[model samples]
Target: MGSTSSGRSTGARDRDGEGRARNARPRDGLGRPLPYEAQGVARQPEGIVRTPEQSVAEAQGLLDAGRPFHAHEVFEDAWKSGPQEERELWRGLAQVAVGLTHAARGNVTGGARLLRRGAGGVEQWAAQSGRQRPYGMDLVGLVAWGRGLADDVEAGGGTVDAQARAPRLRGQVP
Candidate 1:
């Protein structure tokens, strides 16, 4: 199911320690690569500007299912099509999703960087603007989760257990 731009197999012949076929690079639990070309996250349907309410539900569902790449697409739609005033909020959420995607693929360094970057944006907005519950969701918790995951990956000497180490994207109603 995975292939590179050149139509070559994405290292499916490679096997992990468990003898399970794995992609050459990092992969999801199922062995799909990062930026997995998920149909869900590729683009938003035309004329669809999802509300924060919609985004919270949609993104949360994807994240919980271990489909962070799909979740990123949902957040990307919000960043691209949602209200201008909430662009930063959506963008930060998207970054968090992408960071999670990176972690899922076992890219600890890249994942940690992105997780911190995304968390900072969301945390900064809350800290500076006094909007503790932007988008009626718990930004503080989400940001902390990202930071915690980043910290774990960063401190790991090498070889992060991404699936086991993944942090939940808690979506609470504010």
Candidate 2:
């Protein structure tokens, strides 16, 4: 009864009991919304608190699996729950994941811009905090990776293989 002429639901959007909008829509690997009836990759739950090590591990796995959007969500959780001093680190990592998602999804301009922005944010945070390898992350390597991927995406003007371009969260310093 809540369906529109197109046979899609037309009432209030899916929501939790608290009345907050919940997107029940399925999503592709890149996090693009799919039709309600279409199957989707499992979504990472929101707002869970995890230790820095756990966050890094989980996000790295997702990135390596070519699920950068999921990796972004994992980083988002850390950004929201981590200590104030580490918020920028997590936020920047999330942005880098999303940048990869954009590049994989064929948004070349947006992908390149976000990659650079995220790399710059990470670099700035490391300079300000002087914790280049917090929680075993190789900030310098990740920044260089993100920036280099951005350059490649821009030059190609096309989609990229997200897994192939995924950055190693832990890598040799320098």
Candidate 3:
């Protein structure tokens, strides 16, 4: 509903300063617009903190369901709400999920790059947190998983196979 303030509607559509449609909206992969209540969506929830164990478990469940993007949401929540010390770990995990999402969407080059970056971040997380397995996560295993995906992407010549597989989200890397 864009108006020129002269009791006239902007014909057909209106472009914003960036040349995007003024009324353009965000939608999920399935092409559904965000819910009415979530239109001006906030990136993270406020005042909702979960234990590290809980956060990891929830992310894993989402990943298991072939929804890495959703898993990224859980990881991002943990990054935002959990202790500062564990923030990097959560952020790294979220990055991995996002990388997987990109691969699922056929952005192999971007996905490979992000996956490698995330894997490195987890290693940094391990060093900074002074725990090889903080929050009971198998950091090494997760790192390997990300790297493996990146390697697979590269081996495929930067284009992911349509049936490319995603890593599992459960158990230790071993």
Candidate 4:
């Protein structure tokens, strides 16, 4: 690394062909950037469109694997690609996933705040849409779970077990 005249290190930044800054760094399960030479978990490709069922399944799988950061990306895709009216729902889900990621990464304050915000977003969306079980998701239950997790994380004041605390997106399975 070379130092610039302004005393900043002149490290090469990852950029796309168009000169847009795009970080190509490998990331850990919680989305923390790793050293360039370190092997990391494969990242979720962005902007892929999927059916609602597919989105739920994929995000749920990531969540189960304790990769809430990746799960958040899946939900972000849904928020971008899904119907406009449902954007809030997907965005809220993404926020909840990110909250879990923060919790797992030991940022208790950020984790709790995001969780509460996400839960509130989803709860309000559900109330307005009157679709409590959209795409097999139990919105009411998810809201309660997210809020409860927020409270617990704040109370505990430490990193949470992401896998142990993963939310059940749907209601009881048969």
Candidate 5:
């Protein structure tokens, strides 16, 4: 209910005001708002900043190195930070990693289910994002391969053939 010098009731103080919200924290050294600043900045948590393509590249490296679990963790981190519109793609990638981990552990049924779920996620992303085409070489591709392997297993077939053809899940590119 306080009025500013211009005779306007300023519900909140501006940056120059010493009587600003007590909970407000100072700006950081970079002249940006501090991490805990409660006011003067929108509270929306920033999403992971890296592009999905970058995530894919990193995940591929992990796959090449035979580190499905690590790749899954990366995808999960990306998925959490990706925009809402692209969250599914990251999740799909992570799911595929999980599927691969299960396969490596000899949990065929679990792997199959995870792969199918990943495929569904990527397929949905494709429909929503309108990328290359049906099962393009991206999240969609990862998911499609997972689904294919899952289906192969369900049909009493050796899914290793599909795994062999699947894009590398991780590796350190020399």
Candidate 6:
């Protein structure tokens, strides 16, 4: 259910015709915003726009769908476009996806280290952004789960408890 059939259609229509109708913003086939339009951060001369929030949400959706490597790539692309303030935040998030990707592959030690670095960077970025930090399950929760996995690996733990964890945490494994 990560992908919706109407996403592209709605996004295109929203971009090409009705711009002021929706609050959720338009998205591309990949679920990322087209640029400048989604957030309505700035006015443009009539074209598609994608916002950081949309891009992050798309990446999060991919991560939730068991695609952290893809999520890492998406966030990396978003990060490369510099706004100075949000740039580092995207970078940290991209790293978080990478860390989660590693953890999913059972590389516990590497995942833990990357998670630590990402956590530090994202926490700083979140504070600076002054935006309520993204939902904890996305990044913070991943770091904790990665840590738990690392601890389990160190102590020779068993399979992670799917039922015991939240849905968002599921992204950490796959």
lDDT (Cα atoms) of all candidates against the true structure: 0.70, 0.92, 0.70, 0.92, 0.61, 0.55
RMSD of each: 9.4, 2.3, 6.9, 3.4, 14.3, 12.6
Best by TM-score: 2
Report clash pairs, candidate 2: none
lDDT of 1 by residue, 44-160 (tens): 233356777887877777666666766777888888987777778878888887887777666888888898999998888677678867656778888988998888777873544
Model 5 earns a TM-score of: 0.58
Model 6, residue 44: distance off in Å is: 27
TM-score sort, best first: 2, 4, 3, 1, 5, 6
- Shift in Å, residue 91, candidate 3: 0.8
- N/CA/C clash count, model 5: 12
The estimated TM-scores of all candidates read 0.67, 0.94, 0.69, 0.92, 0.58, 0.53
Point out the worst 10-residue segment of candidate 4 by lDDT: 3-12
- Prediction 3 TM-score vs. true: 0.69
lDDT of 3 by residue, 52-82 (tens): 7888787676666566776787888888888
**Residue 93 alpha-carbon offset, candidate 5, angstroms:** 1.2
Tens-place lDDT per residue, model 5, 63-132, is 6655565667677878898678878877887887777666655567987888888878877887888874
As a TM-score, model 6 comes out at 0.53
Clashing pairs in 3: none
Write down the TM-score for model 1. Answer: 0.67
Please write out the lDDT profile of model 4 over residues 3-72, one tens digit for every residue. Answer: 6564545796778788989788789888999876679999999889999999999999999999999999
What is the per-residue lDDT of model 2 for residues 4-120, given as tens digits with 9 covering 90 to 100?
A: 655777875889779999998899998999988889999999989999999999999999999999999999999999899988888899999999999999999999998998999
